[model samples]
Structure formats: structure tokens, C-alpha cells
Target: QPRHSKRQPEWHQRDQDELVVNQPESATLDESQKPAYADQDSGSNKRKTRGIQQENAKDTVVLSKEISEDSKLAADKAMEAMGANILTELKEVQTNLKKQITDQSGLITKEMSEFRKEMGKRLDDIVADLKDVKNRVEEAEQRITEVEEFNMDVKDVLSHTLQLQEDLQTRLTDLEARSRRNNIRIHGVTKGEEGDNLQKFIENFIKTELSLTDTTLGIQRCHRPLGPKPPSGSNPRSIVIHFLEYTMKELVLRSAWGKKVIQLKEKRVFFDQDFPSDILAKRKAYNPIRKILKEKGLRFQTMYPSRLRVFYQNGPVIYNSAQDVSDDMRKRNMFEAAGKPTEDASQPKPGAFSWEGASGIQRWTRETRVKHIQEKLRAFKHNDNTL
Candidate 1:
């Protein structure tokens, strides 16, 4: 058998509306048609419908595949373009970043060079300043050394000058003391009573006291030395008598030495050599020691200008100054004081016994200062006793 061929019917809207109105004709045809023929038609119609549906499906698949191919090609082109653009942008960004890095590196290198130069210049300047400071320090040290040397020379010159001045003063004082060797100060003499016959009256008194009437004693000026007169009703001014020979003065002093009081017209008087004030002060300092010697009956004599010569049993012991005498006496345990003796004599004397609450200055103890003060006070008291 041959395969059955089928045709699909096309129905318009007007043809379907006309068939609806002609339904009796369709019924009469159905009644007259054979079963086989009707089955054939129906099968043919079903086959035609299936064939149309398959064709439509094949066409739709082709169209869809074509559309998908077009869309995939367009997507591929777009992606290529986008990828090219992204690659170009990335290259540009990389180039720009590389250029910026290069520029910054160059700038940093230049800045570093400039900084190096600046730092080098600063270091050089600092080195120069340090050198200058070192030079200045050396110069200052040199100048200080020179100043110290100059000060030393000036101090040496001052010391020599002071020594010379002291020597000159000592020589002058010695000369002055020697000059007054033949002079005697007759204390407690009635002022203005000696008159023009002052030398005659003194000679008469000397002759009567010493029995030197036969001796021709040469007399110099006899008068009161220039000074403030004593207040009225006090003792008369002292008479200063100058003898031409030192022997006559010595004879007068030795003769009057044992006498407690000498009378001039029933008024008591005394004779002493006219010594310098300094020598008088020094002589007064020896009185205590002298009294000690006299009491012990030791042979001691006051030497020229206030030196003391003690005739110790061992030999002659001479003391040049009051300090020397005092030191020697202390060494020999000659006397004792109420307070303990100071151990260190080199320290400066203190102003008082209680030095607490005082400024922080090293000072001698009370015992040392009191010893000096007592020495001076006793010396002054001795002077009063002599007067």
C-alpha cells in the first residue's frame, strides 16, 4: 500500500460562520458517508494536524537556534570590546602609576641630595663652631693662667714691699728709742714751778738725793714735753729732762731705782726713761713675769727696748718679744689658768666663749681668746701700776 498523503485545511472566519449556518448539510453528509471513508477522513485530518504541528515546531526550533546564534555572536563581540577596553584602561592605569612612581622617585632622590647637602653644610658649620669654641676655651685657659701668674707676681711684689716697710718701721722705731736714751721723764713734778732754773733745780735735787755734788753732770733742755695738760686739781704735768751724757741718766735711774718715792719740795715724784709708747706697752707686758722672777730671786734684767734676759740656772735665756716670753713660759709650765689650755694655737681666736648660733666660721675656743685678752688686760694694769 502507498502511504496516505494529507492536506491541511485552511478555514477563514467567514467560512466557519457560513458552516455554522449550514450545519444540516454537514449532518446529511455525515449520514450518507461510509464508516471507512469517514475513518479515512478523520485519520487524514489528524495526520494533517500532526504534520502542521511538526513543521511549526521545526520552524520555531530553527528560528530559536538562529536567534541564539545571533545573540551569542553579539555577546562575544561585546565581551571582546569590553575586555579590550578594560585591558587598555588597566595598561593606562599601570603606565600612570609607573610614571607617578618614577616622578616621585626622582623628586625623592633630588630632595635627598639637597638634604644631604644641607646636612653636610650644617655639619661643617657645627664643626667650625666647635673649633672656634675650642680655640676660645684654650685662649680663656691661657688668659686665666697668665692672670694667675701675674697675680702671683703682684702678690710677691706686695709681700716684698710689705716686708721692706716693716723692716723700715722697725729700724725707725729702734732709732727713735735710741735717740731718747739720755732723756728722763720726771713724773708728778709741779707744773710751771721749775721756771727758768729748771735744770738747776733738777741738778740740786739729784745732788741732794745721790750725793753727786762733786760730779759735773752735763744737762740739756729740761722742760715739760708738749701735751694736753692735766685737768686742774690733778697732778702737775710731767717734766722731761734731757742729760748730755747717757751715763748721768743711768746714774739717776739707778739711784732712784730702790727709792719708792722721791720728794720735790715735799711733793712725791718718780723718774723713768723716756721710751717710745710701743716700748712702754711691751715693757708693761713683762711686769708679771718680772715679778715672778723677783720673787724667785732669779737673776733677770729687762734688756733694751723691752726684751727680757732671764738668768736661768742652765744659761742665759733671752726673750725677744712678749709673745716669745709667753710661749716659753707656757712650754715650761710656768703658770696655770682656770680654763684648760687650747690644743691648737694656729686657729683664729673667737669673739666670745659661747659661739653657738653664730655664722659658720671656724674660730678658736674661749680659753685661747681669754688668754690673749687677759694678757693684754694685765699689761694695761701693769702700765697703770707703773704710772
Candidate 2:
């Protein structure tokens, strides 16, 4: 039912007819010269021409087969050549890639080595620094330990020194008090009352004023304390009397105390035992307590070297320091009657014995002792260094 072109078959038939008509003259005679057997000859000639055409067709088929085989061989050879070229190019590319990979690997390995070395060096430096710091810290700790030990030794030395100083001071005070034992101080006498003969004047004055019948009063020496003469209207300096006999001195002092109120030239006079300036300061600190005792009608006696003996209704109590007496008065609830302690009683004079310890020795305050120790230590260390 579909229409197809028939021009190919027509062209093939026409080509076959032309091939028969174009045959050579040797193969076919002219029609005019043919015998009466032309029909048979023509049949035979057609058979021969057909045979030749068959052989030519066979040869053409063989030639076409050979050409197809040759063309396949050529095409196979060309494909093989092209494959070889592509293989060579692939090998070159592979070689280049391998070289690049090798180069990159080497570079990477070299860089890694450098990085490792640098890190190792930095780590070493850090380790060294840590070691240095540790050593310094250890040294500082050692120094601190030494310093603490030195401070302890210094404290021990200072404590011993303070004890020795206290002992020295006690001995000195005792010596001074002993020196002043037999001396008596007379006050309220006008200046220059003894005139030229000091001993004669004192002997006559004591017998007359003190009512001493003993005319043979043994006297060693007598004089005013070394100082400038007092101006007019001022209280005269006391007369210090040194007697040869201690008993006679005691007798004279007792007589003066018994008199209570002695007058000379219309002026009231007083007598007291001569004491060192330091002991006097310590004794004077008791004035406030003495006044309180007097006001309260309590009898008390002052002992040698700054001591107080209170005669209470219950019993007699002795105190070594004014602070102790004040404390006792406070305990007895008698301090309020006198108000607060006077400055002299509360604050002691410098270089004055304020309080006595259980050992009967006086001590400086803790702060004062430490400060002195530090100064001494500094001086000692400086001396040692200089040596």
C-alpha cells in the first residue's frame, strides 16, 4: 500500500542493454554478412556473452571482496596507530602527575621537619624557663626560712638582754638608795642661814629648834645641794645633813617627825629622809593615794624604794608600786571617793619604776622591748657586716 521509487531497477536494465550493444566487433558479425544460420549463431553468441558477463560479475565480486578486506586491514592499522599515540600521551601525563606528586610529597615532608624542629626548640625554651622560675622560687623560700630563723634568734637574744638590763637597773637603784641612807634633808630654812660656820650653825640650830638636850651631836658635814641661789620670795633649797652615825641620824629624823610642825624664824619647817631623784619620783607618785588615804582616815606608811604599807581594819597590806596600791583601793571601792587617779599615779615618770612583777623586777612594755630589740639587731647586723 506504500509507493516506492522504481528508477533504480530501470537504470540497472538500461545499463545491461548498453553493455551488450557496446560489445567489440570481434565478438559479433554484421547483420548483412550473416549466413542463413544467424539464428543459431546469435543464440550461441548470446550464450557466450552471458558466460563472459557471468565471469566478469564473478571477478568484480572477488575484487570487491579483496577491496573490502584491504579496507578493513587499513582501518585496523590506523586504529592501532591512533591507540598507540593515545597510550604514549597517557604514559607522559601519568609520568608528569607522578613527578608532581613526588615533588609535593617531598616539599610537605621538608616543611613538616622544619615545623617539628621549631616546635621542639620552643618547647625546650619553655622548659628551661620553667626550670629557672622553679629555682628562683626555691631560693626565695630558702631565704624566707633563714630570715625567720634569724628573727627567732634575735628575739631570744633580746629577751635575755632585757633581763640583764632589768637586773642592772635594780642593782643601780639599790646602790643609790644605800648611798642616801644616812642623809636627812631639812626644808623651810632661809637661804644662807648657816652663814660662815656651817657645822656650828647647824649644831646650835638643831639643839634650839628640835629641843635636843644632847649637846654632843656628832656631825660629819652639811651643805645645800649644788644649784644656783634662789631669788627673793622663792622657797629656799633644802639643807642636806650627813651625820657620822646612822643611829643619830635616825634619832634626829624621828624627833622632827614627832614635832609634826616645827617653826624657824616664824616660818614652818619640814624634815624628810634624803632619797635619790628617781626614788623620789617613784615615791611622789603615791601622793594622790596618800591624800585619798588621809581623807578616808586610813593609816598608811611609805616604805623604802617606793613601797606602801596600808594598815586596814582587817590587816596590814604592803604594795611594791603605786599602781598596786591604786588597784587595791579600787578593789576596796575607795577610788570613786577620790575620783580618777591623778596623772602622777596613772602615768609614771620616765625612767621611774611603775610596777613590779612576780619576780620583783620591773620591765618595759612589749612594744618598747621589741622596738629596742629591732634597733639593737640592726646595729648588730651592721657591725657584723662591717667586720
Candidate 3:
């Protein structure tokens, strides 16, 4: 229960100094320095000395115990003070470390918040751009649909217009052909052979060449076709003869058909019905088919305005175009029957009527030509009588 001191305890230092002084005193005292009773108290002095030694040892033990107790108390107090200082320092360090951690956590949270906001803004921008692209794609699809519809309409209109044009062309060709029904074309006559009076010259030439002196020919007009005249030795321009009456024209044609060959001024001539150039072109399209039919020995007749009447074993089939004829021939397995053509097949036949003059008629026997002419004449006479 002693009070604590900063320096060493004063009681401990005083005890040490007393022990030193007493040690020197006990060591300096001698036997000669003992008093007059020394001899009489020698035994007593010896006993006293023993008692003093025992007392000193007891004192020393007591002093040592006291010093040791003081030292243990001081050490315990010093250790307690050092422990209190260390605890205070540790508390301060922990508080500072906690504050630093809180500050760092706040800074990190702020940065994370900013990053999240930026990422959200970028996402919104991307979504808006995607919406715009979707709208544009829809608009493009709508425009494409409109274009497709417009294209379909244009195609329909174009198809209708083409059909209408084809019909108009057909009607025009029919009218042109009908207008030239009573006209006759005379080919292979020399240039200027008809002289100034072309109508009279035609009438005279027909009557003499066809032996039609008894028949009356009602020739309304006669003239060459409107074109530049041919050079010498080339083919002469045709003479178009327009008859006043269709029946008289038919009669003349029938008579001309009866003759194998007709000559005018010692040159061979040809007679045929005149048709429009369009009709002529359509008939010319049948030339390849006609050659094929001729090679196969098939009987086929070219009707007016480019119609073909093919005589088949089953029945007679009529075709308006060479393509139809070809298809039918293929179906009947007769297309290959024509086979390869000879070198001379492409060449024109001698004394044969030209395609422009005779509507591309094939060569026929004299009897067949006569028979067809008779039938046509009878039909003409019946129609005339009916009118």
C-alpha cells in the first residue's frame, strides 16, 4: 500500500545506505578496543556476537524481502502504465483506419454510381437508334410493296394494250384484203408492155392468152404498182387489174387457171389475186411448212389471208399459223417425215408462180388445179345469182 514514485523509492535507498554504514562499523571494531570487563564477559561477548550475527542476518532477510516486494510493485505499476499507453495508441489507430476505409468505400460508390448512369444513358441511346432503324425498315417494306403493286398494274396495262394493238392490226389487214378482192396481179410482163392504155392492154392480153374472146371482162382500172421500175433483164413491176364486177373477175381467174402457161409478147406471165403486204408476209411464214408438207407428199391447201387447210387421214385440220401446223405435225408424229431437204429444195422451181403473186400456192397436178378452179367458179356463180 505504498505510494508510487517516478524515481527509485526513498525508503529503499535509505535502507541501502544504512546497511553500508553498519557494515564498515562492524568490520573496524577489534578485541583490544573492548572495555575492562572484557575478561570477565568473554563468554557473554561471544554469545552476544552470535546473537548480533543472527539479528543482522534476520535484518538482511527482512531488507531483501522488502526490496524485492518494492521492485515487484514498481514493475507491476510500470507494466500497467505501458499497457494503458499501448491500448490508447491502438484505439486511435483503429479509429483512423476505420475512417479511411469509410472514405474509400464512399469514393468507390460514387464512381460506381456515375458509371451506372453513363451505361444507362448509352443503353437508352442504343434503344432509340434501334427504334429509328425499325421504323425505317418498315417504311422501306411499305415502299417496296407499293412498287410491286404499281409494277403489276403496269404489266396488266401493257398486256391489254398489246392485245388491243394485235386486234387492230388484224382488222386493218382484213379491211385491206377485202378492198383488193376484185384486183388481179399480173407478173413477168416486160416494162412498158401495157403501153399508154394500160386497161385496154390488160383486157386484150387476158383475152388472147387465156382464149377468153367470148367472155366479157369488166376491167375498171389497170396500172403498175407504185414503185421505181426495174432495170433491164430484172423482174418487171406487176400490173394490178381492178375489175368492175367480182363475178367477171372470178371468171377470168378461172379461165387463167385452166391454162398451164400464159404468154404475153412471147414472154411467160403469171396471174394471181392481189393482197395486202401484211397478208403476204403472213403467208410467207408458211413456206418452211409448205416445203415440209411437199416433201411428205401431204395434201395441204393455203386458204385466203394465210390460213392453211391440211388434209390428214383422220380429218382436215385448219391452222392459222405455221407454229400451229408445226405443233400438229409433231403431235401426229409426221414432223420427222419431212427429213433432210435436198440441195435443190431451197431453189425456186422453174415456171412456178412466185409467193408474192400466188399466195404461196404449192405445185399441184393439172386436174387438181382445174377441180379447185371449177369449185370456186361454181361458188362465185351461186353467190352472184343469190345477190
Candidate 4:
């Protein structure tokens, strides 16, 4: 409820009036004109400031472009100056490198030439030395070959000489065997013709012993003769024994009067010497034993005591003969035994059969005349079952 009266305070009123300032109409118009003037002045000042800024901007742009151009020009000039200096230094270094290469090439060429000359001299000397060595070796090899050939020749000669000697020895052996023509030999490991020879000796010994008729043994109580013939048939008979090689034979002979035992070979021997009974150079044997037996009164002519005469030798006993071998006529007096004349031949004195005849037999048994005949047949025809 506010009243519009004049009783209000003067300040309130004054505030209102001042806020709504009530002046004369002309004065109000005049104040409004003053603001227009101030606005024009501000507008003018702003335009002037804007114009100055545009001019400063244009000037700064022009100066920046000019400085950029100047800096480019300076850089181009510096590049040109550095290029000339670098070219000059490069030329100087190229000249120095060429001189050094030339100097090194010359030194290497000179060294190569010297080395070639030295090597050529050394190679020539080596080649000459090798040639001399090869020549000497060839000469030595030739000498060695000659020596080898000579040694082979000497060996061949010695071999030929040895073969000749062997041939000669073989020939000598053949000649010795040929000289004895059908002549009987009495020898062997223990007996030879001596085998049959010893047989005859035994018979002769028996005949002498039994002919005494003084022994208590009966005439038929002994062994018989191994001869091919009978003891008696009213005729003289011969006993043949052919032993061309080894004769390991034995004979048992006898008669009604006595017994004859003959051992042809008991040991082996040569034609010129006695028999050997062992594998020794020499040894005591039966001959010595026989000698001792004779000393003890045992009668064995082959022993040293019996002293057999060749005239009565029934075996080819190696004994002294009763006749004189020097006198040819007296030596062959066989006819004188039967009261007949003696005959002679124009043969040499040593070529007589003085070594043969009489009853050349040895007996080991005494059998009847008929029995003796049967035994010979038995020996010849009888088959030995033991074989």
C-alpha cells in the first residue's frame, strides 16, 4: 500500500529522480549527442591500431624471406670452396700411391730374377750327381750278375762229378757178381751154401759118431737127412741145393747107422767172410763156442778139434784137404779110393772141383733105406698145412 504523496523522504525521492534524471528536454538531447561523439572516437582508435598491425606483419614477412635467401647463398658458397680443397688433396694422395706401387713392383721383379738364376745352378749340379750315381750302380749290378753265374756253374760241375762216382760204384758191384759163375756160396745171416753145407757137415759128424756102434742109442733113434735122395739104393746119388739169393734153409738128415743135423744158415754173412749174428761191428759167436766145446771133449769139426779133411768132407766145409793142393795130380786122386787111375784136364790148378765130392751130405736122423725114400717124397710132395 504505498501512497503517492510528497511526505516521502527527500533521499528516496532524490534516488528516484537521479535514477530517472529528469532534465530539460534540450539538455537530454545534448547528453545523447555526447555519447555519439565518444563512440566515434573509440571506433577511430581501433581502426588505427588494426592498420599499424597489418603494416608490421607485412614488413616481418619480407625480412624473413630475405634472411632465408642469404643463408642459402652462404651454404652454396661454402660447398664450392670445400669441393676445390678436396680435389687438390685427392690428386696429391693419388700421386704418392702410384710412386709407392712402382717402387714395390721393381724390388719384387729383381728378387725373382736372382732366385731363378740360383735355382737353375743348383738343379744342374743335382742332375749331374744323380747321373754319376746311376752309372756306378749299373756297373756294380753287372759285377754281381757275373759272380752269381759263376757260382751256379761251379755247383753244376760238382753235381756232375758226384753222379759219375755213383755210376762207377754201381758198375763195380755188377762185375763182382758176374765173376762167380754158378759157383755155390756158403753164407747167410747164419748160413749160406753153409746152410746146406752145414747140413752135410752134421751128417758127416753123425756118420763118424754112429759108425762106432759104441753108443747105447739105437741106430734108428735119431733124425733123418733132409737130402732129396734116400740113404741107400745101391748107387751113388748127388744132393743139389741152389740158393742164388737169401737161403734161410735147414736140413735134418740121418741114416740107419746114425743121424746128421745140418744148419745151412743161422746168421748172415758175405761171400768172403764169416757170418754176423747181431747188429754190431764184431761179437763172440758159435765158432768160439764150438772151440770151447771141443776142449771139453765134444766132437765138432766146425769147432777147432775135429780137423776135417776135404777128401772125406760130405759138406762144403771150409777145412784143410788131405791132398797137396800144389800137386795137381795128387790133389784129384778120387780114382785112387776105388783102385782106379786118375785123370787130368788142361784147366788151371785152382779151377779143380777139389772143393767138392766124396759124400757131400749132412744127416740128422737114422731111418731104414725104404723109410729114407718115403721121407724124401714127403719133403718134396707133402703140402705144408702151416703155409
Candidate 5:
């Protein structure tokens, strides 16, 4: 019977779902603390243990009291030990959970730092690109300004050269007529003095405009006549404009100043005010003045545009004489003057007649033309009386 009743074969361990189902709050307290309705069957286990202990007592009433005291002390000790074990388990679980939270916080901090650094690098690259663009824009603006100044200079040169051409033509005619009266040609009437004066004027203009030091511009000129054989030494001269792009470089002849080249110094400031390019653009839509300006240097001299046919194309002097001055006469004049006459196919033939439009007749507008009239009007400005 004792073998069969041995704890009923421990039903909590054998043939059971022994996994931790619930850590109930009630399980924290002792099962013995409950009263079980104060009934005999309900409290049988505790009562049986007490009665067996009492029967095993072998001393008198005083001895039995001492033994019951010892039993109560042992039960109190067991309960205290169980409470300590439960507290230790709770502390271990709490420590592990706190460690996990700290590790997660560290990982998040590291990721955030890496992301911040990456963003900073990208922003730096963007700022550098913006700086480069700004520099290019500044450079482009500077180049445009240089081109504008060069264009203005070309305009002035064209006007001045035209005036010179007219003056030379008028003087040549007077000299030729005087020589004809004598029936003997007057030689040695070269334009050396005038050519030097024109070159000096160019240098002074550049100096005045730039206010620069160590700057010098040299110009040379020669002239020729366009006609049949007039004489061996009667060809006109040309006014050549030359400059040095750099100090050590070869002299650059500025035959035709185009807008595509000419840049400002590296450190100079850009244009302080807007240029006339915008106005030119508008005018060019209906009237391409630029084309005329480029094609024709300056059709000067006569009151009508048709007279422009008598001017030089590439040379300074245009020899417009009476018809029948054959090629033999022109060659003789070219040699007497010791000048080589270059034939320009673009020039009009001798005695060729044609109807020229507004481009042929209009001199400078009335306003700009006044300067020419005034030069002749001024007394004592020149020794000659061509006016």
C-alpha cells in the first residue's frame, strides 16, 4: 500500500504539458496561507501532519511545547528562503532587459552620426559647383565688355579714315589741275607728312582712353590710284593700322576689327553700364546697319551716295580722273611715286555708270556731317583753300 501511494507517481511531471503556462501572481504566496472553508476533508493534509508529529512526541507537556516551537521556526525559515530565491530571479530578468535597451540606443546613435556626415559631404560638393558657375558667368561678362569697346573703336576709325580719304582726293585734284596748267607734271608730292600725323593721332587716342603706362601704337600708310594708264608716279597711298597683341609677339595689323576677338585684361573690371548691342539687335531686324558698316568702311566725300563709287576699297586714296587716262599713264605715275598698285577686283571700273540707292547718297546724318563742314569753314585751319 505504501509503494502504491508514494506521492501518486508525481502527476505534475509524467505524461503532462509541463511547459511554463502562467507565472500567476497567486503562486508568489504560500498555499498553506489559505483556510479552505475550515472543513475536516479540506484541511486534511495539514491536520494529518500535525497529528503524526504529536504522536511521535516521547516527553511530557513541557517537552511537547518545545518541539512545536522548533517546528514553527523551521517553517518560517523555509518561507523566507523561498522569498529570497524569487527576488533573485526577478533581479536577473530585469538586468538582461536593461542591457538590451542600452545596446539598441547605441546602434541608433551610430547610424545617425554616419548619416549626418554623408549629408555634409554632399552639401560641400553642391556649394563648390555653385562657385564654379558664378566664376564662369563673371568671366563671360568681362569678355562681352571687351568686345563692345573694340566695336566702338572700329566705328571711330572708319569715320576718321573716310574723312582723310576725302581730304586727299580733293587735294590730289587741285595738284593735278595746277600741274596741267604748267604743261609739266610736278613730282615729289608724297603724303609722308600726313601719314605720320594720322599714326600719331591713333596712339594718342588709345592713351587718352586707357590712361595706361608703357603703351605705344605705331601706324604706317601708303597710297595708290585706281584708273587706266594715267602716269607712272601718280598712285595714292594707304593708311595701315598695326598693333601688338602682346609685348613680345609680332606686330598685328588690325585690318578689320571683328567682334569675335579682343578680350579685356585678366584683372580689369567689367562694363559699368550697358552697351549699344541691344539697340543694334533691334535695328538689325529691319535694317542691318551692321552689314553695311562691315561691308563699306565709309562711303565719304560727295554730297550724294552715288559719288561713293569714286572711293578706294582697301587703299587710302581713290584715283578718280577723267576717262581715257589709259593703263600706260597709270603705270608711269605708280613708278614715279615708287609705289606698287594692287588691283582690287571689288572696285568699280573707270567710267562705269550705275544708279545707287539711299546707301549711295546719304553721308553722315546732318548732325554728324556738321563736323566735316565746320573743319572747312574754320579759317586758318589749313593753308589750302579746297573748300
Candidate 6:
């Protein structure tokens, strides 16, 4: 039922004729000279028609096969050309990759060598600096040792110098005490009592007080000792007298011992051998004992340079200091504890021979002696209250 284009047998003949005409091998013929199929027999005509149809069918088949062959050849040619172009591009890419890998490897090797050299140089410099530090440390240690030795030597020198200074001070004090030996101090004397002629005033004073007109007592100089005047209402300053001979000073001092006070123009004066400041300080410690000895009518004298000498009937007892005298009094038991008289009346009196204790030896310690002196003072106070 669908309509299709109808094929014409004459069209195929015409195409074949055109092909034959264009060929040099084909014959040229007129239409009038061609055989007429209408004038032939029916059997012969049928054969001719069948033959023509078969020939036409053969020509169509040949044409279709030729066309298919040509198409297949064209497709093969195109495929080969495209494959060649792809292969060429792939080869070029491989070459470029190889060149890039070579260049990068060379650059990395060069940079590594330079880095190694720089590290080696820095390590060498560090070693040198450490050696210099070590040398400086050793030098500092040496200097410290020397300084310590110098300090020790300086300390020894200072200690020796201090000891020498103490020795010098002791000798100087002794020299000063010796210088005052030939002089006497007349205490409680009114200022200006010497009048204008100081020498004549002293000569008259000795003659009148000691009744020494028969003896020749040589006098050298007389004056008020150097010092500020006493405050108003206080005792006047003493007259210091120097003798031509030390014997004359001793004579005047001995004669004035029992006479506790001397009178000069209605003023009570006292006489003492001149002593240095240091010895006077030492003598002040003996005042308590001196008062007791005086009341007992005991004959005791302070010897040259602050020594005390007591003349007992046996002989003389010399003491270097007031502590020595107190120790002696303690052992002798001259004053009893609490000031009561000893019950043993057979114990000789204070001025007797027993005071010279077994050829004058001490048996008590310093502390015991001090305790005895305190008890004696207490006993004296108690006895005076009872009286």
C-alpha cells in the first residue's frame, strides 16, 4: 500500500549508452540500420526480451559493488592519517619531561655543596672562641690567689704594729712616774700664801712645822701646781715644792706622818709626797685601810710609786696593792666577823707579832679575801652603833 519510486528499464540503457559513448572502444550506429523486434517471430522476441532484462540486472549489481569498495577505501585512509598525528604529539611530550628532570637534579647538587662549606667554617670559628675563654679563666684564678696571699701578709703586719704600740705606752707611763720623785705637794693651802718670795715662804713653812731648824734642808723651787682654781667655797689648790736633794723630800714627809693636819695662817693644810696621775689613782684604793690603820696608831707608810709598807714589831711587811693588804688582814683576823672581839682572848692583839703570818705567807684565795673585807666593814658598822 505504500508508494515507491518506479524503476525504468530505459534509464539503465541510457546510462550504459552514455558510458559506451564516452569510451573509445565502442561502435557508432544509426537508428534506421538497427534490427526491428516487431517484425520478428514471437518465440525469438520473447528470448530477446528475457536476455535484455538479465543483462540490466547484472549491470546494477556491478555498479552497487563498485560504490561499496570506494567508500571502504576512503574510511581506511582517514583512520591512518589521524593515528600518525597522535603518535607524533606523544613522542614530543616524553622528550620534554626527560630534559626537565636532568636540569633540576644538577641544580640541587650545587646548592648542597655550598651549604656544607658554610657549616664547616662556622664550626671552626666556635672552637677558636672557646679556647680564648679557657685562657682568660686561668688568668683570673691566678690573680685571685695572689690577692689572698697579700691580704694575709697585711693582717700579720697590723698585729705586730699593735703589740709594739702597747709596749711603748707602758714605758712612757713608768718614765712619767719617775720624774715626780723629788717633789712634795702641800694640800689645803690658801692661794697666795707664799707671798712674793716663794722660796723663802717654803723654807719658813718647813722650819716652823717640822721643827727642823737644826737640820740643813735644801730647797730648790716652790709654786702652785698647774690646774684650774677650785670652784668658790671648795678647798684651795696645793703648793708643789721641788727639793735640791731627794733625801730632803723624804725627811719632810717622815716628820709630817703622825701630825695628821698642819696649820698655815689659820687654814688646815696637809703634806704628801708628789705622785704622778697614774700612781695617785692606784693609791685611792688603799684609803679604807689607811683610815683603819691610822685609828689603831699603826706605823705604815706608802713607799715610792704607790707601794704600802707596814712596820710591825717583827719587821716590815711590803704590799704591792690594796688587795694585798686586805688579804693579809683577812688571814690575820685583825677584826672579827660582825665586829665582835674574838672569844679567844689568847689571839694576840692587832699590833702584835702574829700579824707577820708564818714568815708572811698568804693562805686564802682572792674571792675569800674580798668576802672577809666586806664582813669586817659590816662588823665595824655594828660596833660603832653599839658604842
Best by TM-score: 2
For residue 17, give model 4's deviation from the true position in Å. Answer: 54
- True lDDT of residue 330, candidate 1: 75
What C-alpha lDDT, on a 0 to 100 scale, does residue 144 get in candidate 5?
A: 86
List runs of model 1 lying over 4 Å from the truth.
1-129, 148-171, 190-216, 226-238, 263-268, 291-299, 311-316, 337-387
Candidate 2 residues lying further than 4 Å off, grouped into runs, are: 1-137, 227-235, 344-387
RMSD to the native, candidate 6? 23.1
Rank candidates by lDDT, best first. Answer: 2, 3, 1, 6, 4, 5
Query: What TM-score quantifies how close candidate 2 is to the native fold?
Result: 0.55
Residue pairs in candidate 6 whose N, alpha carbon or C atoms collide under 3 angstroms? 338-379, 339-379
Q: State the C-alpha lDDT per candidate.
A: 0.72, 0.79, 0.75, 0.42, 0.41, 0.68
lDDT of 3 by residue, 241-307 (tens): 9998898888888878778588866888888889887667567778888898888787999998789
List the candidate 4 regions with Cα displacement exceeding 4 Å: 1-49, 148-162, 165-387
lDDT string for model 6 (1-387, tens) is: 111123344778696687556633212334454455433544564685587668877866776665567666766777777788778877787788778877877887788788878888888888888888888889988988998677556545544554554466457667876677788988887767777887898888888898898887787788887664567998887788888888888989888876767898787778887776556656766776676677666789887677899877788899987777777877877545323222222212233232224457535433234334444555554554475
The candidates, ranked best first by TM-score, are 2, 3, 1, 6, 4, 5
Give the alpha carbon lDDT tens digit for every residue of 48-121 in model 4: 65875575566556655666676677778888888988989999989999899899899999999999999999
Weakest 10 consecutive residues, lDDT, candidate 5?
Answer: 267-276
For candidate 4, the 10 contiguous residues with the lowest summed lDDT are 273-282
Top-scoring candidate (lDDT): 2
What's model 1's overall lDDT? Answer: 0.72
Models, CA RMSD each: 14.5, 13.9, 15.2, 30.9, 29.9, 23.1
- Worst-scoring 10-residue span by lDDT in model 6: 340-349
**After best superposition, candidate 5 residue 91: deviation in angstroms?**
22
